[model samples]
Target chain A: MDSGTESASADAWDGEIETEIGHDEYDPYGTLTLIGIYFVIIALLWVFMYFVEFLGEGPTVM
Target chain B: MEIHRYETIWFAASLLLIVGFIGTITYGAVGVGVEMVDDSGGTVDPDNLGSHERFGDTGVHKVNESHYEVNMIAVHPSFIPSEIEIPAGSTVTFYMTASDVTHGFKLVDSNLNTMIIPGQVSEITAEFDEPGEYGFVCHEYCGSLHHEMAGNLSVVPEDEWGGVDS
Candidate 1:
């Protein structure tokens, strides 16, 4: 997907969660799903860094 | 058969690169428990030592009094002042800063790996314990020309420096 759609979904999730926790609105409509997606992305990045050595030990020909 | 030859050569070259990368990382971070010195060295003053004139030397940079100061500008695949010769027992402080991106500053046979941020000077010091040819290169992959960023450092004894036998 394009970067714009990805970011829009992320921001929309954050907004929805904030609304759910506030007194003005109580719409918990699957906001936890957004949080799960965020965690998944973070975990994937951690794995990539651990094995691929991305930008850690300088540059490699391989 | 010709493709096999190419594959073998590629494999060999890649193996050497891996070895070099491992050496760089080891020298950069291994066996150093103490805290690293803050890399900010003295501010750059071209007129203080007239160092601006020494850029792009073909490997034997002539500095005065057998002792000198230098600024190794970070660029794609290498440091700006690529090759250098320093006298033994003297500390050569590298005033490093990247012009392009974040590059790794490290020395072979010593722990000097540091992140050189773009537009921010990071000072690193190195003292050669033995007079010999030491290999060093930028461990950070900035671009496709990364292999060309390699260079050699020669540490000569004080007596042999400046053509003086003393």
Candidate 2:
């Protein structure tokens, strides 16, 4: 093969694989789902602690 | 700089979280009418605490029909008038000072906590809605017997409460 053709083949064999996916088209549905769960948990804990642990624990200072 | 949509969303969520915390605290202060301890208790001389007017007669006193005042002194190893009795369903203000070193007063299971400095009086006001017995401790490490420095606060019923006269 010619030098240019050989170089091109070598570049292809160097572990570079082309794909149809683009950076902008990458969907992070899994990340969004995990973060949504985290948000719900944090909100619930906040409510429980504020209402149950704090306000319910009476004899507080006025 | 370019930012991802998810990053922007997360940033907004973090801001909302902070604002939510501040709002909750504000509601507790304004809506629930929770007050904090301030410098209104004034100052006193640690050396002459025995001769001071209020600390000299350290005990619980009924100020009015619904209000009470407690004058307390934190000495080295114990509190003067170790047992404090007050009436439930009344507002009680604690005026405290330390004689030798800095100390701490923390009423257990309650929100009353303050530092008792030698020359400064620490004051906190709390209301007891139910008759119960609570314990207080010197939370700050001042001396060798700091761990043993504790007291009791008894909130008795209105009918069972013997006022300062009794």
Candidate 3:
């Protein structure tokens, strides 16, 4: 029964799907843009925290 | 196996982020001259604290013109020298230990924080640039009245600073 269904689906779907481009050709520009923005935000926050928040709150231990 | 271009880029970016974090910490330590608490002060028997030289007489003492040493003890619910006074623009080294249980010493709104262990001494050096009063509290919960374990650090102006007792 499993072999029958597998064969039936294989025959039905054989020419139904078409690959226009390879996976390697895909460029995730949106992901790169989003990550770049996130990186900038993190860097800015780190600077604000280290310099403004930490160093600003002085009388610090050496 | 083939990897995507974005995957390689992301890997490189991740490496950059890690390296950047290490660089920042290194800069803070080297450039900013931030020191960390360590075991340089050595160990002591908490039970025999009364015989110990420094912890026995726990208070602030002037080392020289620009340096001072504060020997402190943290017991159950209080610091031995509850009130501390120092001159402004002086480097103060706090040498502390615990008698009974473990406790924490945290100078509120400052970077001065360390653990007080029974058999070990915790030492931290701090520099106060201005004359002001800073409150400190034991952040680690040790006993029932842990919240009551608080103290004050007063940095007095240079003109009004008193010399150390002999």
lDDT by residue (B34-82, candidate 3, tens digit) is 8788888899999999999988888888888899999999997999898
Number of the candidate with higher lDDT, 2 or 3: 3
| lDDT ranking from best candidate downward | 3, 2, 1
Model 2, residue A37: distance off in Å is: 2.4
C-alpha RMSD between model 1 and the true structure: 18.8
Model 1's alpha-carbon lDDT is: 0.57
Lowest summed lDDT across 10 adjacent residues in model 2 chain B is found at B157-166
- With candidate 3 superimposed using the best TM-score fit, by how many Å does residue B149's alpha carbon deviate from the native? 0.5
Provide the clashing-pair count of each candidate structure: 6, 0, 1
* Tens digits of lDDT, candidate 1, A1-62: 69999998888757444323433244344654564566567656655653355334322111
Deviation from native of the Cα of residue B156 in model 3, angstroms: 1.9
Off by over 4 Å in 1: A1-62, B1-35, B42-67, B163-166
Error of 1 at B7 (Å): 56
User: Tens-digit lDDT track for model 1 on B1-166?
Assistant: 2344334545775576567657645644554322355634533332232344322222233345543555677777777667677777665656666667778766665555677666456765555556887677778887888767767767788887653121
lDDT per residue (tens digit) for residues B1-166 in model 2 = 7677777888998899889988888998989877778888899989998899999889998889999899999998898868998888999888999989998998888878888899999888888989999999999999999999999999999999878723
Model 1 chain B: weakest 10-residue lDDT segment is B53-62
**What CAPRI-style quality would you assign to candidate 3?**
medium
